[model samples]
Target: MEFRYDKEADANYVRLRHEQYAYREEINTERRIDYAADRKPIGVELLCASEGVDLRNLPEQDAISDLLSQHHIKVLAS
Candidate 1:
């Protein structure tokens, strides 16, 4: 998983490549739970703006924080 901000393009995106499914069942179950909970899960990549809104001038960390804050979403990781 990687987080990057493109200054020229003024876009912020997150890239997560799953090399292998270590716990396929667990992952699937979690996905189901999310759906059942009626939560619209958002990935980092979806945050990118394709309209050429460059956000790269700002600090990457700050930009990410702002996005989550605006969405009222809390990032939780184990």
Candidate 2:
């Protein structure tokens, strides 16, 4: 997958387009998990090189690590 940063928007987003049914199914599963969670999730766009990239493939911790490494952003462990 590929990642791109949008300087003007001050954000990084991943784009994925699905042309297969399996990919659609995977996305549905992720949506269900997100909905079932007790805490609300903040939606952020991501950039991906693969079509139909699943957000589930993007782990929260990994993203946090990337944020910290790329932008020197810190996350206080709670």
In order, how many clashes per candidate?
A: 3, 5
lDDT per residue (tens digit) for residues 9-44 in model 2: 444443222122121112342221121133333333
Per-residue lDDT for 72 in model 1?
Answer: 42
Error of 2 at 1 (Å): 2.7
Task: Output candidate 1 Cα RMSD.
Answer: 12.6
> Which runs in model 1 stand beyond 4 Å of their true positions?
18-43, 46-78
CA lDDT, every model vs. true structure: 0.35, 0.35
For model 1, residues 1-78, the per-residue Cα lDDT tens digits are 345555565444543343332221113212211111223222233222433232232234355555544544343321
As for candidate 2, its clashing pairs are 2-49, 13-46, 13-47, 14-46, 14-47
Point out the worst 10-residue segment of candidate 2 by lDDT: 17-26
What are the per-model C-alpha RMSD values against the true structure? 12.6, 11.3
